[model samples]
Target: MPIDNNYTVKRIPPSDVDLYKELRLEGLKDTPEAFGASYRDESTNARSYYYTLLENHDVFGVYRNTDTLVGIAALALSPKEKLKHKGTLWGMYIKPEARGNELAKQLVLQIIKIAKETTEEILLTVVASNVSAITLYKKLGFIEYGTEPRALKIEDRYYDEVLMRLPLT
Candidate 1:
């Protein structure tokens, strides 16, 4: 089902640092293969680190009832002049309880909408085994450009990543 009016999509402000941290750590822990960052490393960082993330990236959240933040996705525009035309869609997650409500798609769509304003292309990487995410990205017009073998390693295991891009130009 589509998300109803009760769910609001908005750019997360710096004041919501704690909420963003909580949800981010949850995603990192619950799905280690899905992210490049480790919970161990991020959990050790100061609040200022997360503040910098909010300051540097376009982090958008999906809220329920105006108070509960259930999902998050971010677009990081490259700072280098040569790469500035490209933006990366990263750090996307939705709480388990909020799954099946189409929150992930909505979050990604919001990122794409914002990315178009500044980027000629939006790029993303997903764990190759995550069929659901791959399917969703394809449906949203993201084309698979390549796959990186063993892109992420957690403990003794490795996870490959599928590289995808949506051309905005």
Candidate 2:
């Protein structure tokens, strides 16, 4: 189904740390393999950590009913002088109840739009087994570059990630 016209997308500010953190933890716990960070690690972080994330990156949130945040994604621009032209798309997640409405696609397109302003390219790594996400990235013009074997290890199990990039230049 197409995204609901009522759903709105906007940059998540630090003031919405509570809402963002809740959604972030839900994603981490629900789909451990899709994200690089584990709930165990992030759940222990101080509120300041989340504050810094909102302060430093372009974190986007999709809201249902214009008030309830249901999805999130971030575009982290490299601060290093050598990598300043690069940006990484990470922490993308949509609540189970909010999936299948093309919210993820809409959220990502907004991220790409923001990234294009400052970065020469956007990079992302999605778990190899996530066919749907990989397909979505391809549809958005991301090209697979390579795979990183054992990209993430959790409780003796390993997951490989497909590295993909979309050059804005």
Candidate 3:
């Protein structure tokens, strides 16, 4: 499906921390395996922690015409000199209802646009079991570089992740 024309994609500023946090927690709860962070760990964080995330990370959000935030993606640039040319793409989530509308693609394209200005490459990891997400990343030109076995253990089960990277330069 094509992206909804009414949906607007923009960089989420720190002043909108409450909205971003709400959408983030929803993502963590809805699909725990898709994200690296667990709901248990994030739910305990204070408002300041979320605000700090906005301060340090470049977060982009997709909002519906009705003023509801439906999707989010974040880009984190490496501060160290050795890794300054690389950045990590994380915290990408789109509401279930918002899926299939290309909002995820739009969000990612926006992140990539912003990332190109500062980094030569962007890296991300998707759960091996999540074929849809992996497919999406590949469609956006992210190539798999490696895989990490048992990357995450939730309770008794383990999940593997496929590491992928897209070079901008």
Candidate 4:
């Protein structure tokens, strides 16, 4: 998919494990409630583990003209036969400086384009309090089907998640 000239979006290959890890850590730290994994949990993981993720998951990144990775989104497809027609969009985040632009929309559109090739639908869960993110998802055709209460507990606070899906077929 073609993005703006100021930014380029592409999949993060295994060779770029370090870059992927760096971006992932930045996302986890910047928005702890946005992701399912904790910074502490991923911080201790080995380099090989990150490489494995790059190999197994369809992870995409947005890079500025200077070649700096500023955004990321990932798609994970289930292997089970019953769930093969569905995929999950996860770990989507863009740097604070890159937020005003439509980088996030482009990144997600790329994911949906790739997902439609094999999956009939895509699923995602965003923190209920993330109104902007929820609005973006809805703008991209995702509809909320349910809410998962206490989906995440960071320290003593619990965060609810709004479950959403976009049908590709």
The TM-score values for the models, in the order shown, are 0.96, 0.95, 0.95, 0.97
* lDDT (tens digit, per residue) of candidate 2 on 31-68: 99999999999999999999998998799999887778
On the 0 to 100 scale, the lDDT of residue 95 in model 1 is 90
| Global Cα RMSD, each model | 1.8, 2.0, 2.1, 1.0
Q: Which digits, one per residue and each the tens of the lDDT, describe model 4 over residues 1-169? A: 5476778999988988898899999989889999999999999999999999999889999988836888999999999999999999999999999997889999999999999998999999999999999999999999999999999999999999999999999
| Model 2 poorest 10 in a row by lDDT | 1-10
Candidate 1 lDDT tens digits, 27-136:
99999898989999899989989988887779999999888889998999888999999899999888999988778889898899899899899999999999999999
Better of 2 and 4 by TM-score: 4
State, as a TM-score between 0 and 1, how close model 1 is to the true structure: 0.96
Residue 82 lDDT in candidate 2: 100
How badly does each model clash, as a count of residue pairs?
0, 0, 0, 0
Computed on alpha carbons, the lDDT of every model, listed in order, comes to: 0.91, 0.93, 0.91, 0.93
| TM-score (C-alpha) between model 3 and the true structure | 0.95
| Candidate whose lDDT is highest | 4
Model 4 residue 116 CA deviation (Å) reads 0.4
How well does model 2 score by local distance difference test? Answer: 0.93
lDDT score, candidate 1, position 121: 96
